[model samples]
Target: MQIATMYFKDRAQLKLQDELLQYNLNKSKGKFVGKRAEAIRELDDFEATRDAAKSIRQRVLDNLDTWLEIFEENARARGTTVLWAETPDEVNRHVLDIAARHGLKKAIKSKSMVSEESALDHAIEAAGMKVVETDLGEYILQINDYEPPSHIIAPALHKSKEEVSALFAKVHGTAPKTGIQELCAEARAVLREHYLTGDLGITGANFLIAETGSVFLVTNEGNATLCTTLPKVHVAITGIEKVVPTLEEASTLLRLLTRSATGQSITNYVDILTGIKGAGEFHGAEHMYVILVDSGRSKVLASEVKEALRCIRCGACMNHCPVYQNIGGHSYGWVYPGPIGSVITPMFIGQEVAADLPNASTLCGSCASVCPVRIPLPELLRKHRETQVRLDLRPVGERLGLRLWTWLASRPALYAWATRLGVRVMKWLGGYEGRIHSLPLASGWTNGRDLPAPAGKTFRELYAARRRAGRQT
Candidate 1:
C-alpha cells in the first residue's frame, strides 16, 4: 500500500467527520453497539482487569531492557531465530534477504500493523515477490492496490459494502453485478488457494513472551494460523515493544486485548507458540524468522513518553474516541490512528510532519477513559502540542499574533486601546444587523455560521457608570 504522512491537525476535523459517520454505519449494520454493551456489562470486574493490564505493562516498560534480553534467550532456546532491525530499510532488507535465501516467490501474510508501518507490502512487491494478505481486512487492502488501512482491525471500515463488492469484482475477475455473498465466497476460494500454494508466510505477534521465545497471535478468522503454518518459510515482523517478561504476563495482556478490542472473551483462535516444523510434522513452517523492528520505538522509550509503549494495540481508544469515530483512520494519514496515533506519529515521523494531529483533539479525555492500559492519551497529545509550539511548528500567523497579544496583555493602557479599536472595527463589520456573517480574522470560526457583535458599552464604561449611580443613591 502507498503510505502517506499527513500533518494531523491540518486534516483532523474532516478526517474525524468521516470516521464518526463510518463508525455509526458500521454499528448500525454489525450489532457492535449491543455486543459491546453486553460484553462490558457481563464482566464482573472489567475495570479491575483493565487496571491489572495497565500495571503489568507499566512494569514491563520500566524493565524493558531486562525483559528483552530474557525474551531473546528464551526464544532462541525454542529454536527460533530473532533478528533486530534499527530502521525500516534494515527491516525490509532483512526480510528480503530471508526470502532471497529461500528462493521464495509467493508468500502469505496475516494482519500485522508493524508491517504496515514498515511499508512491507510495497517493499516485497518491489522485490519481485507476490505477497498475499490472508486476514480479511488486510486482504481487502491488498486487493485495493494497497491503500493504507482505514481501521486497525477492519481495514476497509471506511468502505461501504457496495464499494467492497465493486473492488472484489474488479480484482477477482468477477462480473460487475456479483452479489456480496458471491464476492465473499470467491475471495475465500482464492485466498485458500494461496494458503495451499504459498512458499512463505509472514505474521505479526500480539505478544512476545521472553521466557519461551514464543509469539502469541490473536485472530477471529484463523487466517493467522494459515499464514504461519501453511507456508514452507514463515517470517514474523513485530515492534520491539511487543515483548513481555513471561508467558504469564503475555496471557494477562492477551486476555485484556480480546475483550477490549472486539468484546470477545477470547479470540476464536490464538496461536501460542511458533518455530520451524520438525521431521514428520503435519503442519507448521519449515523455516521461521522473527524480525524485531525498533523503528522509532527505542527513541520513544528513551524519552519520558515511554508510557505510550504500554499500548497493546487493543484499539479501544480509537473505537471510542469522538474524533476518530467521525473522521475514521484515513485522515490521520499514518499507520496508527486516533489518540494513540496522535502521540506516537509525531515521535516517529517528526513533529513538523504531524503537527496537525496533536491539535486535532478537543482534549476531551474520552481516549484516556477507555484506554486499556491507562495511557494518559489526552495529556500526552497536549504535551506534543506544547512541544510543537516551542519548536515553532505551529502556524506562523497564530504564533505572531500570540506574541503581539502577550505584549498588549502586559500593558493595561495598550490593552484598553486595542479593546476599543477592536470594538470599533467589529461595530463597523456588524453593520445594520449588529452581526458579522463572516469576518476575515475569524473566518474559520464562522465559515458556516455568524459571529455575534460585541455589546455597545465597554465593561470599563459600564463599571464607572454603575459606581456613579451608587454614589447618587
Candidate 2:
C-alpha cells in the first residue's frame, strides 16, 4: 500500500469533511484529557517524574551504544537471541527467516508500533502466514481487512460503537447488535484460541531493560501477556532507543507514560518479562527473541531533532494537539502522528516526504505542555521549518513573500510606512464590516474565517503616542 505521509495536505482536506472521523476524534481526545487532568491533579510529583524521565533518556542517548551492547550480552546470557536490524527490510527479512525456520503457519500479535513501522504483518502475510492482531482496536482494523491504524494508542478510535457492532457481526460470526462488553467477549473468545494455538507471537516493548534483558509490555486488555506467554516462539520488535538502564528508570517512565497517554495512574497490565521461561516456570516461550530495530532511528539520534527520541510513545501530544483533535491521526499520513510525528517524520522519512508537516501546526505549545518527557515540540517544529527553508523546498510564492517581509522589516522607515498604508487599505477594503472576507493572494486564510482588519495604528505608533502623552502630562 502506498504510505500517506507524503500527501498530508490532500489527506487533511478529505479528513476535515469526515463526520465519523470528527466525532471519534473529539470523543477520544476529550475522554483522555479528562482522565489525564484528574491523574495529574492527583500526582504531586508529576513534574519530578518528567524531569527524571528526561534525564534518563538523555543519559541513554549519550551512551546508547554502550547500553545496547550491554543489553545484547545480558539477553544472550539469559538464553534470548537478539537480532540487530538496521532497516525495515532487514527487520522483515529477520522475522521472515525466523518464521520460515520454525515453519510457523499462523501468528498472533499485540499492538506494536515498531512492527507497524516495519510493515511486518504484511510481510509475514506475503510469506503465507496469518497474523492476528490481539488488541481490540487493532483486531477491529485487522478483521476489517488491511485498514491502517489511525492513532498511536487507539487504532480504531475512528470507529463508533454502532459501527463496531456491525463490523463484529460481519467478520467474527457473532450475534447482531452486540454491546461493547459482548463484542469484547467475542473477540476474546476468538483470540483465546489464537493464543493457545498460534505458532508464533510478536509484540513491541514499552521499555527494554538493559540490566536484566527484560521487555516491558503495557496494555489495558491484558493481551500482551498472552502474546508473550501462550505462543512457544515469542518475538519482540522495538527501536534501539527503548533500552533503559534499569527497572527503576523504566518504572519512573512508566508512571509518567501511562498518566500522560491514557490518563491512568497506572495501566492495568504491566508485564516485565526477562529471558525465556526457566525449567520450573509453568509457561513462556522456550526460545525468546528480540529484534532491536534501527529503522532510521540512528539518523534521528544523529540529527538536531534528537530530543524526539525522549518520547516514550505515550500518545499524549496527539491527544492534546488541536490540529490532531480536528483532522485526526490518519491525516498525518504516517505510523506516528500528531506533534511528535510532525517534528521527527521529516527527519526520519526525509524533509521532502513530509514537507507539509511542519506547517500543519498552530505553534500553540499544548503538546509540549502535556508531554511527559518534556520534549520541546514547538521548537523542534521550528527547526523543521528552518530545515525546509535551508533546503529551499517551500513553494516560490511563500519564499518570495517571506523574503519581501524580511526586506521590509530590515528597513524601519519602510516597515512603518508600509504598515500604515496596509492598515488603511485593509480598512477601506473591509468597509463597514471591518472584516476581510477575501484578500488577494491569501484566500486560504480568509476563505473560512473572517480576518479582522488591522487596527488604525501599529503597536510602535501607539507606544510612541503613549510616551509623548505621558511626558506632556
The best candidate in terms of lDDT = 2
What's the lDDT for all of these models?
Answer: 0.81, 0.89
Runs with alpha carbons beyond 4 Å of true place in candidate 2? 455-473
Q: What lDDT score goes with residue 230 in model 2?
A: 85
- Per-residue alpha-carbon lDDT of model 2 for 46-67, expressed as tens digits? 7887888899988999889999
Give the per-residue lDDT of model 1 (tens digit) for 300-357.
8986567899999978778777777766788788889888988898888888877788
How many clashes show up in model 1?
18
Supply the TM-score for candidate 2: 0.96
**How far in Å is the alpha carbon of 177 misplaced in model 1?**
7.0
The true-versus-predicted C-alpha distance at residue 109 of model 1, in Å, is 0.3
Predicted model with the maximum TM-score: 2
Residue runs of model 1 more than 4 Å from their true location after superposition: 1-3, 7-34, 176-181, 278-281, 410-428, 431-434, 457-472
